[model samples]
Target: MNFTGQWVAFKTIVYREIHRFMRIWVQTLVPPAITIALYFLIFGQLIGSRIGQMGGFDYMQFVVPGLIMMAVIQNSYANVVSSFFGTKFQRNIEELLVAPVLEITILLGYIVGGMARGIAVGSIVTLLALFFTDLTVNNWWITISMVLLTAIVFSLTGFINAIFAESFDDISIIPTFVLTPMIYLGGVFYSIDLLPSFWAKISLANPILYMVNGFRYGILGVSDINIWQAYGMLVVFVIIGFSVSLYLLAKAEKLRT
Candidate 1:
């Protein structure tokens, strides 16, 4: 349709998404804040006390970036997957597909929604973290850029998962079995450098590692991997996720059936 039409459609989708999550702030927003606070209390305060320093920062400080990134990744992914799948389950996605809106527009509308939730939740978690440690931004650009890119990548990922999901259980599987492990092993609580040589090399395979390290570098000015490499990978994943999501959306028959 025309530019104005597309803009209206986009705004409607984003507004709906924002409103849905905000309407249930207790579920979407409060849970992450409480969970992160518990992590700070248990991992940062209790265990971190005995662990002392990691990568030249206090254990609590070192984990702040990772925890925030984790919040962004999880919420961004969950928001889109659940929202898109809900549309599918209700069989309302066919309406959007038959409408004049472009496939990319639909993809982006959902993505923007996911990114909004992810960034919002991440910001809240970051604020909560301040109570436990003196967090500083070593590189504002890198920090913000990495977080934004990571959110987009995962938002796209959630869209892909939603397309392939046949049931509600399918949506939970990847996050439980796949995403959780990746995040934990992604260097959220510890650095890969602390791993033995062979295992450290293996950690490189986890995409979350680059994201966590890039974010940590932004916050702490240190990283086990080159920052540029992390930036490149994040961009590449965004492209791949976007392409896959578009392809799935194009298969309207398969999706609607």
Candidate 2:
């Protein structure tokens, strides 16, 4: 396809994706906000009070960044995996495969769409966070960059999951078995310093820990992990994920069954 044609195709795919989640605002949006808010109440307020300060800041303040990041990661991944898999389930993806659109355009379109929902839901969670804690951002650029990069990484992962997923159940497996554990253990509620020396070293292996801590550094000016490492991990993931998703997308047999 020509540049103009590719641009139009990209916009159409992105628009459909944004519209799909927005159309079901109650399901796609509200639930995460409510869930995160409850975390702020129960964990940040009730339990946090007893736990005292974490990383030299109020526990609520400390957990807010991680919670927001969690919201972004989940929604971004869910949007693409569910949407693309739904298209496959409906057999509509075959049309795109035979069309003149560039594969990169399709991938970019879905990536942007997932980023939209992820960022949107993250914003909502952030707003709700204000009700519980006072967040003074330490670095606006680091904060913004982390959120965007984290969203892109997970959005790409979701696209990848959708590519290999054969059924709706297949989509849920990763989020349940893999993503959930990573987020909780990724220093959402506690710092790695509290971990035993061996486990703390092991925590270093989890990519989500870098992201959560990077975001926490942006907001609270404190991090257990090096901020530069988080940036490196996110950049590397985006490059690798795009390459993998593109290669998988190019394999027509996967989408066609």
lDDT of each: 0.94, 0.94
lDDT of 2 by residue, 162-211 (tens): 99899888999999999999999999989999999999999999999999
Backbone clash total for model 2 is 0
User: TM-score of each candidate?
Assistant: 0.98, 0.98
Q: Candidate 1: which stretches are off by over 4 Å? A: none
What local lDDT score does residue 213 receive in model 2, on the 0 to 100 scale?
A: 96
**What TM-score does candidate 1 reach?**
0.98
Stretches of candidate 2 off by over 4 Å are none
lDDT by residue for model 1 (82-102), tens:
999999999888789788998
